[model samples]
Target: MTKIKTHLSLAVAISGLAATPAMAQDTWEGMDTNSVRGEVQQRYDAALAATQDPAYISANDPRYIWASEAKAQCGIALGYLKSRTRDEVSLSKCRMAYDRMMDVPRPRPVIAATPPPAPVCNRELPGLIFFEFDSATPGPDAAEIVSYVTENAGPCNWSSFQVVGHTDRSGSNAYNLELSQRRADAVANLMTSRGIPQSALDTTASGEESPRVPTADGVRELQNRRVEILVNN
Candidate 1:
């Protein structure tokens, strides 16, 4: 009986050892870490090449915006690994080499910064008029503006339009800025009430500083208290 028990234990141990290779194969079949590392290196090289030439940088700039965030993640992984395996002296040398490479700056591509196209007023006159002196409530003149927009503005092509409200130089700059943003929200709400989709409009505010007409410091210009519309063309 003792001999039989010992043989049974030996058999179970042998069976487990036999299954180990199959389990390892199953785990490694679909996931090749070395292959993934090679592919990541290829992408990093390509991104580095793009950053070299001005034209390529303009067409495919990885510094300003990532071509693939995954590739940048791979770079971070490589940097971390490099920092780990080396001795302290070697690690410091590697860091200095990386810093020197990064310090070499490249010139930006020469592209004309053209102004955006003018807003298509389309004879609609403006809509959603803003109020002056910390008031969001639209007055009687606002009705005319709303009517013109409803009657004449053509089919909305863009997904969103912006309503930017401004305030005259009156109160604290910060307070006026917040007030201006509220005014913009009020105008956007007005537009939503007139059968336009609320999802298609956004609001922003520029306080006393960004005035339509330049004024002396602390001058409360009524003309500066207005709202402008911008369409995503």
Candidate 2:
């Protein structure tokens, strides 16, 4: 696989400096067990009215699709509400719509795949390390990882490694990005203190914009907050 250079773009680098909290609630609502068809329809319409992006439309409106599916499922329950009631036909129709919509594939958000490991460095062995949340301090976990790089340094002909920090999609993009950069710098400092040459290390940060786990905003997935080391020989 081609070696990947791990570095955050300037936009991300700047954005990470300003960490902000996530919005408390999603604007779209009505996905409830007790929600009626009309309520679901209302929420869907509202969501559509709120968006101006063409790309948003091309990707089937998630709110409407979800509402439609909920209505269908509710129909099945409504059908069974009265075994001998007169609303059987209506209930069946609801179930049918739900089944059909469920069969339709919804558009999934696109995400970039993880890049391959960087080529071995010439002076220091190349390796990657992960850090805990909101902290630049390297815990015991990082020691073994650092050791691996040092052990293999000669054989791999590794010279230097770049530490890239990342955060989950929780706070404001700008803040998270800055935090990530700091985290990367912290890791780099640790390596240097442990006998790695200062010239053999570089650092960068990518705030919550680039996440390992594509969770919704403010979910705080640990996997998303981490650092990646890229070796350059």
Candidate 3:
């Protein structure tokens, strides 16, 4: 009698499994982790309804029992797998955001070295022309100095000339002033004769106000009685 009852139970379980829709088989494939979990739960519920056996072992088929046990283990493993995936995705996004916030070094501007400024001509004639005591006239050797200035003025790039006259303090201030003016005038005339333009020449008389060598009130200094020529561009 017990054997007959077991056979009847097996026959009834077989009929129920045969009636199960084909869509339930392999439904977990191509599903996301959540979808797979939901499918497994649905299958277990359906299997439970078909039989009274708690192990869901129907028709003596071990596949259903295996699937039931596998699903439980899969649920735990899927939870940890999903957690790791979420953390990895978040880490990737954070790294990208940090890179965007960082400053990218740009190419620096190439600075060309600046060439030195061209030399400007601000020079004086090579030598000073000295005069005799109380004399405004040029000595014989003074012609050579004048010639040197006139010859090199254009080549030296001199744009203008300044002729300054000086004298010793041996004479009265008024007489010295007049003598200095005469001396400047003489130099200016000589420059003009040598082809220096009158427009480019300037003349001044200092008398005994500024002397080359300091001396007593009535002292005569040969260096003080002189004319200076300056060139400027």
Candidate 1 residue-wise lDDT, 84-139, digit = tens = 32122222322332333344455564488745432223222134354645676654
Best by lDDT: 3
On the 0 to 100 scale, the lDDT of residue 2 in model 2 is 22
- Kindly report which residue stretches of model 3 are placed more than 4 angstroms away from their true locations once superposed: 1-122, 125-127
TM-score of each prediction: 0.43, 0.45, 0.47
Distance from true position, residue 55, model 3, in Å? 99
User: What are the lDDT figures for the candidates, one per model?
Assistant: 0.49, 0.51, 0.55
lDDT of 2 by residue, 88-124 (tens): 2333334433434445465664577634433233232
Candidate that beats the other on lDDT, 2 or 3, i.e. the better one = 3
Span of ten consecutive residues with least summed lDDT in model 1? 60-69
Candidate 1 ranges with C-alpha deviation above 4 Å: 1-125, 128-130, 156-159
Q: Indicate which candidate wins on TM-score.
A: 3
- Which scores better on TM-score, 2 or 3? 3
